[model samples]
Target chain A: MKFPFLKEAITSLTKKPSTELYPLVKKEAPEGYRGRIKFHADKCINCGMCIRVCAPDAITRTIEKTEEGDKITFQFYLGQCTFCQMCADFCAKKAIELTKDYSMVGTDEEDFMVRGTFIKKLPPKPPVPPAGAAPAAAKAPAAAPAATEKPAEKAEDKKEEK
Target chain B: MFKKLIEKGIEKSPWLLHINTGSCNGCDIELVSVITPRYDAERMGFKLAGTPRHADIVVVSGPITSQSKERLVRTLAQVPDPKVVVSIGSCPRSCNVFHGSYSVEGPLDRYCDVDVSIAGCPPKPEAIIDGLAKAVEILKTKRRGK
Candidate 1:
């Protein structure tokens, strides 16, 4: 039933190349292409969601506070990451997303990690009292009572004036 | 004409070649399933080729990492002309998790042009078959033009 010579010639002549011109014609990638992890540091509220969800414990958040203010530091170790993308999905802050950029390779193990820092401004301090207005001369026990009575008398005088 | 006859022949028998750059092995597994008894991509005249030179379709998985970039490019170049490159999986289209790492050099589009991208961490076998079918259709068009 088969024409051997014609079949062989047709197959040989019709075989198209399997390699795409990847540089010229862009391939339409599928939906939800998980390529790379996109980081939105600005949107991160230091919630520790990404750190907690990371099964490999690849992420760590360090908070530092001083009399001046508070600073949040983030460390993401890609070497340990499983590339599960669970952290990005579970994150409530929407601070992280998986991008279609799968181009990660490093020779040094340490090169895979990333670190970021964020700072918060502190409030100003209250002003100190000026040097001695006679330092409020110490009053005797009896004088203390008189001093308290004087304030009461002053209040009464003000009431009368009003 | 001769071009139409060649296009018809190419549409009848298409060989696929797969490449795993640095993927999580998810897409690779699904691709293997295409040849299994369940899906049996072979029934459609689609067969897996061990070498790029014998293939008409290239199925690529994983993001293009610095380590795999040159090798992928070189291997792909070995494939014949009028080939269709299908990017299968989320990692190849986007970084997924390995994004900001210094070693990443992706978006695949930067390195080479992709013809069809099968989205998913690991696309189902049926989806892959569908994608390949579409690629074959496109191949027919290209052959017609040539």
Candidate 2:
């Protein structure tokens, strides 16, 4: 008896169907799946690293000078995003996160944007020095924060030399 | 009564016509895999039609390039009225990483209004199916002229 394909015939009968039936049974994206970008505005430091690293230019940041401070808003245009995760990697504050939500169907362009607004407090200005006193000017730089003291003196020195 | 039956059939089974402008083949491959036996999209009544004339929904993938601009327009014109245009990935929606390239002439909206856009470099198969299902719903509305 030549049963050329006998080994496969019985094996197929007991196996379950391979079709997923997605509409009826929902599936979950696995861990480390990069789907949608989630921005944590509070954690952001306004460094603009994410913007610099984005290959698609899908990220935009708007800085508005307000009485409160610099009102910085980041807009992630998901429609153009490549999900490359470069923006997330470059974010120093860990503000950018790509979630597992893959359902991205939408009719309007606005529906595809992710926006985050944060206010960065502007650094206080150093006190103005009197034009006549170079000695007072030396003390004036001390009024500013230690981080800005050296740069402030150097800037004033250039102005004086001019 | 016959019209009702036809509507039911249309709802159950929407034929899709896929056109690739200048994609990197990532989204196209996923779209094709949707029909494979493992996914078995046909079980849900979705079939990939051979031509635009027979299609109820058009699935467009890739960025619209200078070469494909006229062809895409012509293809869209060939699709019968009440057809739904589903942009399959980020490239067609906004040219993705290929934005501002010399050969790239578009984001899909530069030609015609995209009815549905699935966002991803190449969207997952499940997401593509989800977008297509939504497109079928929108097609029904467009057919009624609303």
Candidate 3:
């Protein structure tokens, strides 16, 4: 009962290594651990909430007009991020998420950037007769019946077409 | 063969010199934790050196404040050639939340080229170890250049 060394030795023998075998035997990050950022472009409404809440101003949004609509790109610069989780929390659509993967070692500046692109389609413009097309004398009489019957439906059909 | 063996040995054991340039001490704690038994970065032949002259890798933490800029430059100059500068945490890389502060001069890139930048407010212990491992590889190349 007085042999303290004997008891310590037995406990040490039975117990596994205190060290985490990282790089070989990987370990998982605990719950709510804020590490790398994940941006879901689809879910993002481009509200700019994440950018506003970010203390370090690590979040950036760039918009480009495309045939579809607006191509929005969000670049989360991890190098400038504080990992305070404010960006994820303030995101109204929950577009921003903090993943558990903490290994962010990089040889280049671009490696730490988390980028996502989403194209928001613009609503089709309503068709309007051009004033320049003043063939009214000849065209008016021919189109009078059809235009009067269902002009609204024809505009709706044009809106849906690719 | 002897030269190759020596290089291999040097590659295996890398002594790091930690420099604190007005850090919030968050990154510093995580860095110290890497050497503890739980993370045990020493098993990978990594160690914290007492002086910059003795270190193979320089681990810098915090944004370089205007006051500490000169000291940082002087300390870095003391480190011998073929040394790898590994910037740890977001503070050193981009000053994190401290960016644009009156006292904070800028990030580590202003002084010297950073070989490895581990980005986090205060990166996890494992991330620091991984960054150091990568620094060792970079050190190998620098050694060859020398």
Candidate 4:
């Protein structure tokens, strides 16, 4: 008589239950796990790379022109996100990061939104010329062209004479 | 009296009914794993019910395709009041990548109020457990209100 099953059955009784005590004892998501979108507005250049790479169109941007600059706001709706990490990968500035916080549970729609805002300052305008200098500045280029044209006319006349 | 005791009992064990509209099976697989031995959602008093009438929670996965939209609506209607609707993944919440497709009729809120949304392509088993635990809390309150 083979008692092969008896030894295995007895050892099973000593083995601990595989069930995880999740709620009571929190678990951490593994490293590089793409869970939630974290937008770094300060680092973002607003190049629209993340928006382009997003397959779901979960990323939306609104630009409001203010006295300071163009105020750009980016909204990442987690509800529509695929968590593909494409936005993070395409981001040139590393402004978008996929965090390991996988427990993204919420009741309100707004709760799932990740937003960031940044103001892009306008480039400095070139210094305007004074009234007196303006005429001289314009005349300088006009006179230089006339000076070159006179020499060319003289060369043409010499060629005709030859 | 006995009513309060029965209410408490009902709150302790909330049976779930899973409805797949037109999922890619990613979320469905993750949902099943939550009930497996390793994740064991039963330890928290969550059980999968065969029918909507028996369910205290409705777990909806997938983007609602035109083919499934009617059935989804009918099934949701069958669920009793005080039932919590839990969107299992990005699909049900806003249709994810399937948004604006010709067949998809969802982003589940257009049909009913979503009680809880667990956002992911297919949320981790631990995350599913977390969402389910939150649903149980909401269930307790809804029961007390009634």
- lDDT at position B38, candidate 3: 85
DockQ leader: 4
Relative to the true structure, how large is the alpha-carbon lDDT of every model?
Answer: 0.72, 0.89, 0.89, 0.93
The clash numbers for all candidates, in the given order, read: 32, 0, 0, 0
Tens digits of per-residue lDDT, candidate 3, B1-146, equal 99899878888998989999999899999988899898998899998899888998999999999888999999999998888999988988888888999999878998998999898878988898889888988998888887
lDDT of 4 by residue, A1-162 (tens): 888799889999999977888878888888889998999999999999888999999999999999999999999999999999999999999999999999999999998999999999999886778988998998998899999999999999999999
Pairwise DockQ winner, candidates 1 and 2: 2
* Residue-pair clashes, model 1: 32
Q: State candidate 4's DockQ.
A: 0.86
lDDT over C-alpha atoms for residue B52 of model 3: 85
The top-ranked prediction according to TM-score is 4
What is the full ranking by TM-score, best candidate first? 4, 2, 3, 1
Q: Per-prediction fnat values? A: 0.00, 0.82, 0.94, 0.89
RMSD of 2: 6.2
Q: Rank the candidates by DockQ, best first.
A: 4, 2, 3, 1
Share of native C-alpha contacts between chains A and B (below 8 angstroms) recovered by candidate 2: 0.82
lDDT, residue A32, candidate 2: 94
The TM-score obtained for chain B of candidate 4 when compared with the true chain B: 0.97
Docking class of 1: incorrect
Give the per-residue lDDT of model 4 (tens digit) for B1-146: 99878887888889999999999999999999998888898877889999999999999999999999999999999999999999999999998998899999998999999999999988999889889989999988888777
The DockQ for candidate 3, computed on C-alphas, is: 0.66
